[model samples]
Target: MRFIKLFCLLISCSFISPQISAQGNKNISATEKKILDQGLVDIQSVNPEILVELKYATPDNFMKKNVYGDLTHAYLQPEIAKRLSKASSLLKKAKPGYKLLVYDAARPNTAQYKLWDALDDLKIPARQKTQYVADPKIGSNHNFGCAIDLTVVDEKGNPLDMGTKYDFFGPLAYPRSEQEMLRQGKLTTKQIANRNILRMAMVHAGFTVNTTEWWHFDGMSKKQARAKYGMIK
Candidate 1:
């Protein structure tokens, strides 16, 4: 009888070991889980059709390094996710073949510092770099989970020519300067139209585009977001 009891106990331990191993190896920390559990919602849960690349997760961004590490998902505040979904839906209705392609969302504060440090160009003053990347001290709207850097992609998932590439730090990337860039032969009329399509869809869904960067959009006013949410650590 004792031998049979020992055999049963060994079988139970074998079954439980996998569960313990899985729990111990989970990627999310308690703090990150807490953040997800609260005000933030995974954009994939809200709209899986929305294409998310998360440039910082790969080495493709301006930093030229993977700052986001193993994190592959994009999370935004609940309202932000809804607004992004609405924008994508509008884009789909306007152009059945196109979809919103998110490049970055809900950036962590540490990532901001890494970006800041990467801008080691002595030619560009510290003040100017802050214009492109928010000062870590002030924090960015993305850090508050209220902003997204995105563009429109075609049926083939190729990014539409939005005049300038994502994370291009130049006046040509500015939406407000589109005409100037066009006159300079830097941006073609077709590129401008593509940008307008994205802007119109996002604006119709109540997202405000930043004048400086064509791909950047905010779900809420910066003042309101700053007052309401703490920067993601």
Candidate 2:
């Protein structure tokens, strides 16, 4: 979300402690860097690849607090940049005027703390997990600058309907909705169509969709996707 104003509350996701959160940019490794570099070289811009906007935060929902690098100016590592470079070509190949909005990129999962804050503004509930646990804090792929939260925008720069708002995390983002009425709460029929347009385009371009979050996609394959990946956090 450019600014989905979810409320602010600190809850430790797992062994992921505040001290651990302080260890910023932990997902980046040397090999990942190599992939990013070469990936960029192969990345091709769609017909009219362009950067319409680059929003960092909206006062209440900030992402740079304890993460790595500057939050105000988002980053896409190298691989992601490569993938997006291909997105333009992919979109233009599929349909003219199809564009992507890069909402969040290269943000620490701790940045998720701010993302949750925006959930309230969008009426999405935050997972009520307890303060601490024994989980390994695998860390967000964003630490490696691999993950991003965004949606398809029209040539005019308006967000298309995808049955629900980006990052909503509710039942709608599930990517398998059979409920037509459920769509009325947020997106309309035309919006959903536009959403599918983008989703389909992404799938054809070697990206994998997150079952629970339509706006969340990664270029990593099934094996590489679960390679116990970590960044420089």
Candidate 3:
């Protein structure tokens, strides 16, 4: 009877191990993985001072689901990673006690379809949704590993209040609308200043800020980005 129980346990373990391994590799396609291997680098390796929190890898994002499955690493194109490292160094030099906290980077093109489908269920107009998330056909700089969503944090890793959350899809999240938001009391002066500090560092390090999202920054112009990098599908 004991031998029979042991045999059953071993069978269960054998089946479970394969399932777990498959789950680990299922989120990213083979082609995507190969691109990542050849063209991207973990941002942490470029700047150990930067803090990485891959929101899409967990259920804490706007999707409210684990879109990145088991992959939690924040990766970027090699040049982008170097620029991010420079940005981190600039911020630290300027503040001496702050660091950049990254939220998302190097999103797969396949994942863009999931976000697009989820947005379709909402009452938002297609144009409005596109402002926040690019249509998969057009593709985002993130899909090319040339964009990043991030904020500033203090020495202790406490995030600076940027008036809105990372994925906030409203006018309040707009860097261009900060004055209007401030006038409406939706955002404070200090929050705008904090946002500017982050922008200054990234801009000086060769990144362009998006008009709609204060947290979103592109390593290059959209035209240059798409032309230079292949979309990660």
Best by lDDT: 3
Write candidate 1's Cα lDDT for 66-154 as tens digits: 89875677888888899999999999999998998889998888888888777865356777888798888888899899999899999
In terms of TM-score, how similar is model 3 to the real structure? 0.84
Would you list the C-alpha lDDT of every candidate in the order shown? 0.84, 0.51, 0.85
Q: Which residue pairs collide in model 1, if any?
A: none
Error at 125, model 1, angstroms: 1.3
TM-score of every model versus the real structure = 0.85, 0.59, 0.84
lDDT of 3 by residue, 95-116 (tens): 9999999999998888888888
TM-score of 2: 0.59
- Cα lDDT for residue 105, model 2? 60
Tell me model 1's lDDT, rounded to 2 decimals: 0.84
lDDT of 3: 0.85
